[model samples]
Target: MDFSENFLHYVWRFRSFDSAELKTAASENLKIIHQGFLNANAGPDFSNAKIQLDGTIWVGNVEIHIKSSDWLKHHHQIDDAYNSVVLHVVYENDVPIKRKDGTTLPVLELKNRISTELITRYERLFLTLTDFPCINQIREVDQLVVDAVLSRTLVERFEQKTGAVIEMLNNLNGNWDETFYRFLARNFGFKVNAFPFEAFAKAVPQQIYAKHKDNPLLIEALVFGASGFLNDEFTEAYPKQLKAEFQFLQKKYNIKPIDATMWKFMRMRPQNFPTLRLAQFAALIIKANHLFSKIMAITDVSKLRMLFEGLPVNDYWKTHYHFKKQAAAVSIQFGKTSINNVLLNTVALFLFAYGKHTATQSYINSAIKLLETLPAEQNAIIERFTGAGVKIDNAFGSQGVLQLKKQYCDEKKCLSCGVGVKILRSSSNHH
Candidate 1:
């Protein structure tokens, strides 16, 4: 008799019940023609259910509860949304309920009809200690079911990413190029410096950089200066020259730089330093004129990777990770992993947003296709799933797994997850 409303939701969703002996509290035969859609937002538990009571067919919302007394507990008796509820389903029909119109409502109790095995399985799934309730049983789920879930989660992830992009687009006044520039700059910083990089990009608008885009050094100076990196004293000629150039540009453009302390360097690899990332971003800007247009035209993943790979930091950056610091001389080109991250996070999301904004299917398809071609991201969450025997072949699966973790597993919304439903319905023999 003790279970979550979500468990009841799952039962009603899949009709996991003995249909032959279904009857109301008053013993009237109840027939379920349709279970209806589960509503996540509000109003009803299930919408548009088709049910037959006695000899009359009813079509309306269906509300569920653990006990029929919950009808007054939730105050649905006074709320008008419950007025259309044709049938009330519950585990225990302890009391009679009425509609907002003061008419008696029929109730079907599930306590006698639901399998004991299903209840035991539900309790096990919902009361587990693992990060994912189904971690032990996920491997037992059908690969086809997993695939279907992953495919749906992938679309969910895309929609979530596209939603963020749309917000950025609105903030940028519907300028796709500006939105793309900000997103690209954020990815260039990766996780370590994304915040400062985003702040720096906003401080120095893309239009300002587009003016000096013809010259890579000027672009580098502008980016570094607006990032507040130029404010520090440097013993090297390269940084000193950059500082001098930025001073002139800053005054000419009336630019205000972000706080240098905002950029993080402690405990970060030299290759991922903000200075190095900014230089690479500058180089990318120099090479990729009308970047948004170029990205939209390219459909091949290899060519997309090639575009990022071709970016090379200035000669000064070849020997230096920072202004005063020097490291072994190596070409400061963006690594494959970094490029993949950019493509996955920035380029793909941008493509999706562009597709949605313009109603272009090709761009949306290109976004999905690009993720399919890329390798699966190596991260703690993906590794966790991998250790649990979940197969993730590419970024498509990786994105889906991320969505599943954040939206379903982490939130403990197991009843709404496909894998969770499968595990709960498989059997009650779980150890």
Candidate 2:
């Protein structure tokens, strides 16, 4: 009675409870020929079931509840949806259920039929307080099972991440280049400023970038100016020039700037400051015109990495983290890790998404291979999975683990996971 209805559903689906002498509450012999498909919607628990009640065959829906009295409690007897229910399955037969026409409905009680050991296994996995429901016993699961789950989760992660890409593509009227530009700009914000960066990209059209692609200063002016950073008065000559150039471009192109307050500076590395990132982004745009086309042509992972290397930004950015806020001159190279993060989050995602859209296997393979070639990402989620003895060698493994952790482990979908299924099925005694 303390257990969930899902446990009863699982027991019935697997026939884990005693079925040797199944009988209806009215003393008629009952035999389950087919235990209908489990329904997830707002209807019967199972549909299209087949049963033989006292040598008479019946085919219809089957409903499950914790108690027979719940039939009246939930008002299912009066609901037209329950009219087709051929059988009622409950954990406890507290009272007899009647159909709308007032005939007593056949009931199958599972309280006494299910084994205690199966209950213990379910409780161990679903009721525990561990970080992951099966963390304590995950290592004991077979290697093949673990690998299968990870592989499944990897593709699931790809599909899940690319869903947004596909939606954006639809909005862009199937323009792969423009969609790629917007998504890449969003990733350039990394995490903190992704939204504003995306908004900034959307505010200015790609044609304007193409018009001024040859002029790096104009590009930087457009980037910083449109980002609302050029509005402030600057002591430095470069920002002053950027402000003047942006004013010219803003009026000529009818471009609007996002609010400067949208950018965050507190508790962030100066190297990752939005100003530097904007400068790097402008350099990237100038360096790679028709970048999506170039990316599609490159099959090698290193060649893809070369595309983001050595972006040429103005020397002012090398000493300044903000407008007129000059720090000790630092080499303002976009670090390898940052480049790889772009490749992983942006390049690989586009490859996978474009492949899915165009029905090209090569692009899909390239996307997956890129992840496999990249070094493993360092994060708390990866650390926890590695701590649990999960063998993650590269970004592919780490990403898969991240998806598995968030989707299955965090949601406590133990009964639905392959690893959790294996663990629960290991119980030797079944009714």
Candidate 3:
């Protein structure tokens, strides 16, 4: 009766009104001329439902409602959708309903006819925990349908990403530059460690860059800005070396440094903490002064990856972004896949966040390229779960599966899921 409650699935599987030989409780023989797409809301909710009572043929649509009173509750009396409605199908038929001309609507009570197995399955799906709500159904449905389902999941995945982007836009107030930077920082940490990275970004005041624009001082600032090393008391030589450099920059650019705890390195792999992230960020900034400008017009994945090839970190970055007890050489690299992932995240964030403002899907191609090249058990698992169709596409596509697994299938909320509606109805009548 509540057509909004996985109603489309029920209609598709049950063929609820398809058998014209059937009759409603009123003894009117039923004949369905058309049943619109499962999710149809526009035009007519339910298409032709021709029936005959006492040998007089009637031809019109069937209007579905959760409760008989919902007819009046939805203002359907004045609604044109109700105008073509010849019969009201409801789970409960306590109240009477009428059309504009005051002919009482014939009622079809479906509660008893509805499969208990389907209802029970839904109840159980919501009650239990599982990896996939209808994952079990995967082997049964046609491969093509499953493929289509994943494709729909893909768009749905992007839809969610777009929603998040909209939220970010509201927070950033449409400033693309600041939005990209903040989003980048947040994304660098990934979902597991995003807040920590954000705190690191907020702590590294940009004044460090303003104060030491000269190459050496700038490099030192970049390193110290992230190391959690800047907060320590400086010796005479420390101030002398840095201050001596600062004096030269002072004439050209007013230099003042703010103290922030150098990023924590204890117990962390030297490459995994704020020190490395800042170096990466700085290398990126130094290599591309107007980085985003170069690619604002680019949506193609392959071309985007090409654009990023071998852009160097600042020269000083070769020797140090962090001066640990022992120093090393300049051979560090961000995995191609890693960079691709980052770009995919940014691209997806922009595309989805921009909403109707941007329509091109080159970002999708770009993501696909990045994901296709990445190596990981998790990535492989996702690619496998989605099946070997187009392969892992991007941060949006990869994270989308994680989102679904976390949000829907994990909780077994099948009654609320599209696939659940299809499967539960069969399982209800299943012996």
Candidate 4:
């Protein structure tokens, strides 16, 4: 099977070829002293490579390709960047190559040099349809390799999450409190109504809520009205009162509510309904005057839990799911799972983003510690990794596994992954 240039880079970077039998296409004995650093940007594939050809030691950039003719095909001959390329590596020596100065360039063919076992392992990984490309081989890989990769991937996942937070920060003009409020609003909606909740938060700016934050009733009215929940007539006294309050605030602030149809409730638990989430959000807003500051000051998880739990939903919501719909008097208190979800998605990410913005190591460390302290997330992706013999002890590992699966494994980027590299390097010995 024909492989990509990336595969060649992987082989060359790892020295996966038979070094003892190395020879150029023109019959010159060759030895690689150093493979050099792989270049991420344009120019050469590798730079500062040291290769001993015959008796002369050449030091310069190294370029690799599937075919020797790719040198001209890529128009590198006319480009001055290829002038320093001391060694040309190819899988197929299709044609002789000459530099811009009319001198024949030495070519090293890897077709016969690369181990068959390595090719097989690479093919197996790239061609597989499994949930994870390395699922079958993951069990055979060393635990140390898995640990190191997971550790790296955990940081990668945090950085990925940090990107979203950074963008939000940028949009909010570096307003940490506003950004955190928007993020919390989205998480409150969870997966089902996240978009609408986000829209509601954006529509009713944090400044508006800060004005009347002392009054929980007014806050709920604004939130519920801006969510389009108070648009319809209600038989319940609480709904009518909220509607009245919201109508007054809506005109004062010139605020617009999001489309009610955008909020989804099908197949979701009644406790997770959009109305209930909005009510809970208003309660949290009322209790935590400076929400972000209050969160940053506390390190205890129980205190954080209490901060979320102590703020009970309005009495109307305690026995109702929607405006007029009355359910059994089951308490609508924030459950442990919902609280943890906020901690994981909102609080932890807020800490990380704030730490990054302030360049404070302690907050960053706190963010990581918070993730480690939290329980692992329950989802299909984590379950698949567990089934594949990978141990996930906390949110850190689970988050890393999630990043690994989504970014690297799903994209078939095995060469860039530590676990994939380990598996490829060990395959030769196994065969």
Candidate 5:
């Protein structure tokens, strides 16, 4: 079986291997100490494991399975990999698994041996009956313990971001700023509207960013690129003028204009469509042309806010980006809530990325601080992530959210997550 991390932990906790005794088949007195399930790869599937057997303190790999028979069913034998079987654990022990050399491998079956509370915790968490795991029990883990686990989870969070970063890198031509913008745009949709904004960014290429460097027209190009209005042969004067401009720009840059669907306006106010968001994004960029450099330089949260304060968009855009009713033309203005939400999230991720060198604590603190700076989140992404804005909970909550979101929640990797591992291990250790 191409067993993922889930069954591995289940096996370890249940100890399907000869739980009858704490010794391997080789007369080694086996002792299980630390149990980890995050960093394991080829040999044993746990991160940092401490197991002693035969009075010899040995540490290498510890593999877990649903049944002892899985050792061969998963082809662990004859693979030369089973040779490192310091301990074989399983949830259920039916038949004894023999290595290729014909020696009974050590097995621990945990059905009757482990604690009841640990198992209950696991069930409560992975089964998803509530908002969070250990809601009542979470408080039991003192502040120090919570901090330790959160820190570990944060590291897990970083490891998780590495994949997205890699994928994002593939999208951009190795330009960090381009990748940042694209991600920022996608994040605006908060997954529900992600593809729409991504379509927006692609339709308005980096080449265009150059063309409109000093002018907001490039911003307009990006903002309106995914609105689908450009695809129509409208007799409307502004539409016709934009089309004419697009034709010239298209020829100049060899870029194709994207005709992606607008993010839904159904049930949404007119201000929520592709038009307004694009305008706001345009204004933010125009206002803060040196945004990336500023973000990298600043460690203080207030400093970050100062960088973005200059971008309220010129009067012409504040009310018009989203709607235009002839004589009552509205200029588009990016509300403080939307801009700060994006900036804070960006800063959090940036600090998370660069935490090794600088005071990661400041990054964490800044994330918390910026929530107050932002207007209670009116946007969908922030609302979903932070539970309706102006979050009072500290970065500890943020760390949990980072993992709970990025790993368990977003990708459904709960089975392989540290939280999931915690469930199984905690179950095995239950009272």
Candidate 6:
């Protein structure tokens, strides 16, 4: 049928073949005492399987393939690792296989043992022309199972996403506040200019900002100058003053600006321009100097949201999206949606990462609770899952679904996925 080797592994691992009259190719009576643990690494498909053959018990690894000839195709004949395999299971018994010791290995062919209906169901579900493999039947799965899967996926998502933050923590020599500052700086870019913003923050270290924290004007000058925004001549009074101030500060700090070409603005909304974001970011620095400590102390989500809301952006940014470039006056307030995004991405992630680093469960619990309190995010992936009857009403559910779509569905690792496993098992004879 040209199915993948993973499908055969799934069938063998789950014991989906008929076992009423099991026998080896040598016609010896066989019984399975225990189906070994599935191995994700090299050397074996399953390990330490216990089986009875010809009334004698044997304990060793088990290897499975689509055809018996695959043992030769994989060159297992010469590899000493395959010598411990007590049973050679295959979908079809096309040829006999010899162990590395030159002894004939016991073969268990399952050509007619697996049901045709089960194969067809797997083919239809996994081989479908859709991003979500089981979308059509997702609604039929039990709600409790869906919730359980989502909860697990949510933890997986947190683990996957927080890895970069922890690596940054290590690179900063375990400076939590400085690490948080850089992470917050990256998220301030909001994905469009995240790289340049992070580079800009690295170029102008937080210690430099701490020196001039009381002076909001110098902080703005350093942020803009280090971002390469103060390089051009400005005719406007405010930008001219900022340029003059940055020229002195840039020499004092010995800071070099990142490439101006790093920032992007095409097809972007004016409010999301990097210049406005930089001004708001400088305002945030002026407002909160040591932000990581404040975040750790606050458990209430509302207070956390308050940290990003109503930032004191200056009048120049309130009327302009760029330095010396004036646009129609717009409210330069960071919108509610943007505030929530910051809370979710930066605040919750740092809390979770810090909790894991210090072995503190309260911080982890607070992180999850904050996500549950926030509203669910709307995106292309969330929409598809919601359309498939999956209930995702909070950031917790949305994050889990996002992880599921990216890790499981896109990769087509159905055998390892909770929802895919449930559907496959229900469709088969396995319990």
TM-score of each predicted structure versus truth: 0.93, 0.89, 0.67, 0.93, 0.65, 0.94
Model 2 vs. true fold: TM: 0.89
Assess candidate 1 and give its TM-score to the true structure. 0.93
Candidate 5 lDDT tens digits, 202-247? 7665545655768766455545544455666665455556666666
The best-first sequence of candidates by lDDT reads 6, 2, 4, 1, 5, 3
lDDT of 3 by residue, 342-413 (tens): 766675446444534465555455444544443422554476556634234444345645655655577654
Model 2 agreement with the true structure over 1-431: per-residue lDDT tens digits: 35788878877887778898889899899999999999989988999999999999999999999999999999998899998999999999999889998888999988888878888888888888775888778888887788788878988999998899989888999888999999899999999989989999998867788998889999999999999998888887888898989999999999989998999888998888888899999899899877898999998877999999999878887788889787888768889999989999999999999898889989999999999999889999888777777778888888888888899999887776788778867773455
Candidates arranged by TM-score, highest first: 6, 4, 1, 2, 3, 5
lDDT at 330, model 6: 79
What is candidate 4's lDDT per residue for 1-431, written digit by digit as tens? Answer: 65789999998998888777688889998989999999999999999999999989999999999999999899999999999998999999999999889988999998887888889889888888775998898999877889789989987788788899999889989888888889999999898888999999998988888899778889989888999988898887888999999999999999999899999989878878887888888888888866998989987644666788867578888788887787887657778889988988888888877888789987788888888888999999999889989988888788889889889988889899998898888865532
Ten contiguous residues with the weakest lDDT in model 3: 254-263
Candidate 6: where is the Cα deviation over 4 Å? 234-237
- Overall lDDT per candidate, in order of appearance: 0.86, 0.88, 0.55, 0.87, 0.57, 0.89
Q: How many residue pairs of model 2 clash at the backbone? A: 0
Predicted structure 1: lDDT? 0.86
What is the TM-score of candidate 5?
0.65
Q: At residue 273, what lDDT does model 2 achieve?
A: 88
Please identify model 3 stretches exceeding 4 Å from their true place.
Answer: 1-9, 12-20, 36-85, 90-104, 111-128, 166-174, 191-193, 196-229, 233-267, 297-300, 306-324, 327-331, 351-356, 361-397, 410-431
